[model samples]
Target: MARKVGIYTRISRDDEGESLGVARQREDCERLADLRNWQAVKVYEDNDVSAFKRNVRREEFELMLTDLRAGLIDGIVAYDLDRLARKPQDLERLIEIYDDRPRLEFATVTNDVNLGTADGRTMARVMVAFANKSSHDTSRRLKRKHLELAQQGKASGGPAPYGWQKGDPEKVDQEAARHIKEAQKELLAGVRIGTIRTRWQEQGLGNPREGTKRMAHHRVTHILTNPRLVGYRTYHGEILYGEDGSPVMGDWETINTVEEWEAVCAVVAERQKSQPGRSLARTYLLSGIARCGLCKSKIRGQTNHKWQPGSKGARYKYQCSKVNGGCGKVARVGEPVDELIAQLALEEQRDRAASADVSPERRWPREQELNDLNTDIAQLIEAEKNKSISVSTLLQVLPEKERQRDELKLDRARFYKEQKQAEAKDDAVDLSLEEFFDLPIERQREIVLHSLSAVFIHPSGRGKRVFDPDLIEPVWRE
Candidate 1:
């Protein structure tokens, strides 16, 4: 009886599609099996897959191991020693497998190597070590190339961030460009970072894989803080880098003007200055959502009168830090301002809901249509190969099939888009205008605080006053 032999073959991505090489390897392995008087049980081939990586996800390789462990194969044959593995870790795993199984034997054709002796084991280790070093060197070279490209303002890997598009020298994507402009506009208009996130989610923008329907506050903050938006590069946690081997201005692809960038930075700086020594013990219903319309700074709360032995039931007001040198405005007390803003916000929400349209469903092809088209494409290719149809004729027919495929894809995309739009309409919160008008002043204040991004009160010699949106209307409405 002949020994059952498992034939293994592997090729890295660098060696992919070399038909002659693959054929030679297969032939060599088959010949080795024959010389050993072993019946070839199965052939495991992983094309365009790296052996250097652990936990091989290759289907055929896994099946071969399953059969080997089941005692279905008594020996393994390969074209060359390197075909078994080029990684030291993977080679060690193979050696361990062989050591534990007494019946199993490993042999290679071109190398005339046998993994049954100490000398052979040492040789295998040396080969694996060289292969691992080669893999590491290749990885380092690729990283260097990527960094070089980044320095040249070229697309590296991942999707382009919010302000930029994916392409060479010029060719900016119109859709991405529009979103970037809108984000900048919103920022300048004194919209709170949290509000911007909510708006993005409501608009169905940002990366789909992030699993967020809206933009996050942190993401908005990151956008604001990113020097790239101001046309500079930030690398390795530092803004300044050695351009031409000397310290130079950061590599930022400026999207905003210098004045705009300075203004934004000033606003941020001012907000920080105003909030110094403020305790987190103070909780406001809409702390994160409020923004100063003038400098777009966050409005911090200050107690008008302490709840001590002298004062009880005293009020507090939310005022702009004016960090950009103070809008010279006083803050609005908790009661009146909060009520008015909440009512206005609720009204705006209601108006938005009423005006939104329920999008209609788009027609799309069924799954069977797609499957049948794919089958036809496969048949067409087979027919062309067999010379049953002329290559030119198939080429002419290919465009029609490709067009149909593209159309189907577009239709599916549009269908889902319409579905999302309709769902958004249904999800909107509806509040009556009359209810907003009739609500008690305090309740109205609460609604205002919940809804409005911020309320600005003009400065007064006296302490607190009712909130007025008029003083900062220019910034918010812009």
Candidate 2:
């Protein structure tokens, strides 16, 4: 009997077009498996995906774990540890599988020179951390490059933003230019912003996609507010670091005369001052979760108007002191706002529970398949040790075994995580929006804050609030 082994390979988006073809990875793993006399159980491949965000997206990798836990494979092989995961958190999880399971082992072609040594494990972890940081740094560098291109009036990468097409050297989007002029004229005439958006859609102007197209209100607002339309560029919310380790506004480039872009700014300012009150804001139970949205700082509760006649009985509100002291904005009362939010949250909770039911049997792997694969991998490892395989032979075979082990471990972790989450879902809670509205204000507030993530409130007294849907959205257990 041969050792039941699994192989895993991953190629990031940057590696996809380069020399790191999936076939090359498979070939390397296969040649190694042959030398170790291990049976190739399966090969798990995730292509054009980033390892940094692997935990969130890799479903195939999760399935491999189910196979592993059921004893489908004895070990996993991978080209390298980073190929399994770039993030330290996720790498630590891989280490946990070996630490927790006595029958299991993890091997990497490049890094597992000695699995029995503490120093080897430490080196592997350090390498993973470096890889994770590199991925993050690369993302930041890419964003900077885009900003630089935008400043130079070049296309800022993705899908040409409604008015432009690819391969136009001059970057002159004639169609977008026409729409911008029309929108500018409407703004100058003091036409209602929403009406302008409707008109654009009716006339099939500036629709990014085809077929019964309608311009979104937000899209219209963005176009009317863009200084770029007037040949002037404004880097909205550009991140800049100040000298004292604080962030501040940086340099502005004069892409067009201020006078030329005056109409666009005026329209934006007017719209900002007159937006409608948001019902969604009132609906979310938890308006402030971690920090004050306005001040970007933690919110604190303090009693106010305590000495006043009836006002003394009022509860404390959540506000940002930084804003209240002229550094930020006014504090918002948490009680009524939280009450309204709770009502909305309950409705979402009910819906989520209704969607979360799934058959448990379908979620796990077949017992027989798992046992067979485990048996095969065990045999392979036994043969390697008995033959006292040469260093060259071990190097060739180890990676495939490591990949298989890692894949199974990932699958098992995902299964357990999902099971835990599913079990945690509250199905008994009846949370319809109407039902929520009927609940007492305090109960409503309790549900909202507990269920909702965040609520974005508009500055205007009449402005609407945006709710974080996760709190109320029902979990669909499948």
Candidate 3:
């Protein structure tokens, strides 16, 4: 009787995401079975899956073993011995199956093997070992190549990051770059990552890695913290450095200068260390911005439920609570306070827009210091290139200089961010002060905090009959 055979085929990778490798393997295995006049009863395929990789389970290979144990096939045919396994341990497993069913057949098109005998199993083990060595050598070569590319400040091939175009890593997506720059400024100005993510999604920006039009908070953090933002090439999340202790700047156009990137990174690191986890979204328009004029404590939104029958009397108001280090004497109806503050904030924005200064005045003394540091760094690098400064000496001297420059830049970044917040000439919320109610409370709260230092809710006379706008005093920021 002709032996029933299971044809097994596999490929370590499908470069084009197609199973072309396994298709050729299957054709070869079928021809071998035909030559042997064996009935090809089954085809087990583990396409685009690695067999040599440690802990990578080949599902079809395991199923074929199960089938062999159940006496479904008397023989196994593969295109090559290495296609079945690249590890000697894996070969030993198949040998054990052969030892159990001593009459069961195993053969490959590339190599004639008699699995019935111990010598054939030993030969298979040797071939598997050689295949394993080949895979290890290939992996090492690829890793070395990638390290070389990173050292030269080249992208090692993948989808481009958020602010760059795919395939053309050097080209910047202007719109995305603008969004990223705005986000960096916003974050440095004390806006939460969640807030930035909300605005990005609202503006139809997507996380390309996730292949969706929805932005994620973590993705925002990743973009902000990435070395690519400042034009440094990276491999495995680490910035590549040259022998002279200088970073390997990439070919891509950087969104932020090295100083700006370092400043933003430092701020984000401090925030992470202090907070350690996600913060709850702000639900009130002026929770932290409004203060009690009585005790000068921040006010919070409060809801009072009236549990009376057939009465719709749930009142939402802003109040000062003793629990939050506030005097318990202050209370105000929320609607008018929100409206009055919103109108005042609007007028502040319009006034800033109509001011004579188009851009905020920068401190040139500090700016000159930063520029001097850059000149020093450039001269140091030139000395290294000319071999006047040794790599060891450059390494020792450059970092301290860079650190001092970074500290100055961090302070500078803070100054600019605060100035921008104080002079918010652009309509960020895209709504008039009267239309503040239409915006999210988070957005409205952001505008309020940026536009004013504190909104003081003073004590009104007892038995108040009407809301008074004069009772709410807004202390505007200079």
Candidate 4:
């Protein structure tokens, strides 16, 4: 019986208009198999794949390995030893597979090794080491080339970020740019990152990493945090600092000012510190916001089916957490208090909407000031680079300007977010909120927390009495 054989061919990159390299490999492998009188049972081709890249998945190569292990093939053939693997560990794995099946034969167009002999195994390992060395040399050369590009202020290769184009960050993809800005506004308006991700997924936004329509919250957060959005170059998750120790500007239209970017970063960092585990997955609307006016302790939510001795149904209340431990101050019901807070917030929102109109004159001059500040920083950096000023002088000149810019940016984010919320259609009653009664819990929670700094519940003197709204004192956030 003829020896059953599997032919494998791979090309690191596809040539423009054709894949002639893999075709040549296939031809060479087939000719070798024919010379040995082996029956070619399968031909596996992995195109546009790199054997040297450990993370890259080569589907056909994996399938061929599986078939070889399952006894479906008696031998393996490739164009060369390097075509089979470029990593030492991968070569070791192949050798182990061969050792498990002593009858298995390995052949290449340029060389053949006897897997059954110790000396032959040593020779194969030496050949694999050479291939591995070549792969490392190529990687080093590529890294050097990338460093040259960076020194020349050029884009390092790969897909550009969502709103920008590859090799030309100056041109913005308008659709993507709009989405990016809208997401920022939504984030500022108290919408959760997870909620923003779901909305973007439904809008058919594709993630650059996975090329999928749906994205994770961390991905959303990354887009929000990227310094590249403000026209700075970044490498390995950090904004590139020049020899003068200043941020290197990219050749792109800035979506935001550096101050705005830093302000957003500050807000996110502060939130993470204050509420270590507080997430958009919060269960209650008024969990920590409601307080007991009498004891100055938190008012917590609870449900009881027998609160007044005759009530047959469960009742939800925002009561003092220490009701059994000496504090009698409590709100007998949750709904009425929630309604009162919501109504107060709604009135304020309407008033603000009616009064505020941000004209171009009011908005443009501040933006111009931010641009000038960035220019001044750049000039100081350039001066330092030219040895005209000391590093200490540059640092002393820029901190005050940078601080002003950050404050302006934060103010702009807050005002813009408020304007967006005022203009957006309020639909808190849909299942989009997921929890609470008669409204979306997130919207209600945002309104409650934003409008009233504190909702203090005072006890109404011990006896059997009706739940009164007068006993609740609301403190305004402003």
Clashes of each: 19, 55, 0, 0
Query: Stretches of candidate 3 above 4 Å error?
Result: 1-128, 198-205, 208-217, 243-246, 256-263, 278-280, 292-297, 303-316, 322-333, 352-356, 359-431, 434-443, 458-466
What candidate 2 gets wrong by more than 4 Å, as runs, is 14-23, 53-70, 109-119, 136-150, 155-478
Model 2: lDDT equals 0.56
The sequence of per-residue lDDT tens digits that candidate 2 reaches over residues 1-478 is 8888788888775321343666687788887777778887899877666767545676556666667667788677788878887877766665666565655656667755333346766887888888888889987898788677655545454344444444442354676666775555445433456656666777777654443456667777776555444344335434332222122322222222333345356445545667754221222234335344454554455566564766634466655566444234645655555555555556566676678765553443643444455555566565666886665675686567657655764555445434432332332265566665554333444454445545543233345643333322221213
Winning model by lDDT: 3
Residue range 171-289, candidate 3, lDDT tens digits: 98888888888777766656688877877777667454233656767788889878898888888788887765557988888888755676677768777888888684776678888
> Which pairs in model 4 have colliding backbones?
none
Q: Return the number of clashes found in candidate 3.
A: 0
TM per candidate comes to 0.37, 0.36, 0.66, 0.64
Poorest lDDT segment (10 consecutive residues) of candidate 4? 427-436
Candidate 3 has a TM-score of 0.66
TM-score computed on alpha carbons, candidate 2: 0.36
lDDT order of candidates, best first?
Answer: 3, 4, 1, 2
Which has the higher TM-score value, candidate number 1 or candidate number 3? 3
Residue 361 lDDT in model 4? 23
Clashes of 4: 0
lDDT for 79 in candidate 3 is 89
Question: Which of 1 and 2 is ahead in TM-score?
Answer: 1
Ranking by TM-score: 3, 4, 1, 2
lDDT of 3: 0.79
Which model is ahead, 2 or 4, in terms of TM-score? 4
Q: For model 2, what is the error of residue 219's alpha carbon versus the real structure, in angstroms, after optimal superposition?
A: 10
**Candidate 3 — which pairs collide?**
none
- Candidate with top TM-score is 3
